[model samples]
Target: MRINKFIANSGFTSRRKADDLIIQGRVKINGQTIYEPGIQVVDGDKVEVEGKLLTIEKKFYIKLYKPVGFITSNFDPYNELDLNDLLDIDKRFFAAGRLDKDSEGLLIITNDGEFTNNLIHPKFKLDKEYIVKIDRKLRASQEKKFEKGLDIGNGEKTSDAKLEYLGNNTYSVIIHQGFNRQIRRMFKVLGARVIELKRIRIGKIFLGDLKEKEYKYFSKDELKFVDEMIR
Candidate 1:
């Protein structure tokens, strides 16, 4: 297998991230640091990423209803609530995408690297749906501006998004772009503050009846649905 694919199969991260690691000279084949991501690895060949041995692991796909105050990452330097602790399984899984600390809702936890890449990579143009509660009611003008896209700072403008007003200061927001704190930033650009942001769906997968901090493995049908979508 290719070196980047090998690293990804080891459950470290996505193939794209593995390529970044290879380019950074953080990947080694039999103690020789290699900056080439396309290098091939055969059986019995030793592969290491960031000085740690890489081994292919059993893939896992889980859906989690992440709660507020918990961070998505495994390594929390600031000693905050970690989402990993909620899963008691032996396998290590990372969030396919991230929700900010204050955000609550659906998170796909998986050890499949290619799967992670397919879900979050901008090239896929996957729709992620969220229900957001703002500090005030959304104005028609601001809603139009949001649907047409807005400058969210740092010279980046969000792609056109779909905004459905849900009443009571809440709206259903759908965005394909994965900018940092994107939903909040989009609202901020319109002089609105997102008081609550909860992701309800990613493509065909839904949060469903999963309560806060609850999780469940993806069903076979759901997995097939995701596979078809990504393909």
Candidate 2:
């Protein structure tokens, strides 16, 4: 199998990211640096990425309602807040995508590296929907701008977003791209401050009734839907 797929089977991260490691000279095969993502790997051949040995195993997937103030990273060197502390599960899992520290809502947690790739890969065009509440009511012109995408400053512009007025200070925004602090930054660009941001959906999976910090494993039906979508 290809080295990128090999690292992904180890459950470290997505195959896409593994390719990045190879390009960065951070992946090795039998103690030799390997920059080719397609390099073949056979049984008995040793592989390491960033100095850690690799292996494949059963994958675990979870859907968690990530509450504000908790980060998505495995560990945080500052603030001392870890997402794992909110769950009782023993296995190591990673957030498929991310939400900022101040944002809250549905977060995909999993040991399936390939699923991570599927969720965030640009070709998939999966819509991540968020209900955002700003300090005041949003304007129609703002809606048009969101539809066309926004210039969030510093040469970073948002991707095309679908918008729906949910009345008052809230609106539903669906975006395909996952730029850093995308929603918040776009709102800031529009001269408004977002009071709250909650992700309600990712593809066909809804955050659904899960309270803050609550989590559940993906059901067979849910898994099937996701697999079909990714496939």
Candidate 3:
């Protein structure tokens, strides 16, 4: 198999990350350091990564309460706190989508790339709900803009959104689009900067009472619900 695909099938990391490992000379096949990303590997070839055996189990799915200022990556060049450090699991995982470092809340970590694609794909229409705190109060017209959907300014209009005021500069909203910095950009377009943004829900799964930086495994029923959501 292709080196990247082999690494991913071993559940070590994503195919892209596996390519990085190969390029960095950290991956070896049958005791030979393979720096070429295109090198293939067979079942009988012994593999080692960073002097550790390159063997891994199946995929995993987990939910974590991501605090602010941490990146959703296995490695960070800027010396930032990676999402892996927040979890104590033995298996390697990657974020499904991503939250900006300044934003916080529920983040899904999994080893299944296909499943992640389905969850984050725009065509699936999965709803991502957030509890947002804005810097200023929203006028009635601003609420109308949110309800009717606003021009995202890239010539693309955002989908219709649902908003509910939670009093004291806070409100909850559900949006189908997952564009980069979407919620922030939406509020920015409405002249209200987001003071705080927390993704409280994905699909029908809620964060419930999970505390800061805490994590949990999805129940069988919860997984079923998530699977059905993408269908």
Better of 1 and 3 by TM-score: 1
lDDT of each: 0.88, 0.86, 0.82
TM-score: the better of candidates 2 and 3: 2
Instruction: Report the poorest 10 consecutive residues by lDDT, candidate 1.
Output: 222-231
Q: Rate residue 202 of model 2 by lDDT.
A: 91
Q: TM-score of the candidate numbered 1?
A: 0.81
Error of 1 at 138 (Å): 2.0
Query: How should the candidates be ordered by lDDT, best one leading?
Result: 1, 2, 3
Candidate 3 TM-score to native = 0.74
lDDT of 1 by residue, 1-231 (tens): 899888877878778888899999999999999999889999999998888998998777899999999998877888888975677777676788989999999999987878887888787788999999999987899899999999988988998899999989999999998888999999998889999999999888899999998999999878896677435
Clash pairs, model 1 backbone:
none
TM-score of each: 0.81, 0.81, 0.74
- Return the lDDT, model 1, position 127: 93
Residue 136, candidate 3: C-alpha displacement in angstroms: 1.5
Across 66-94, the per-residue lDDT of candidate 3 in tens digits comes to: 99988878788877898767988776578
Off by over 4 Å in 2: 1-7, 12-53
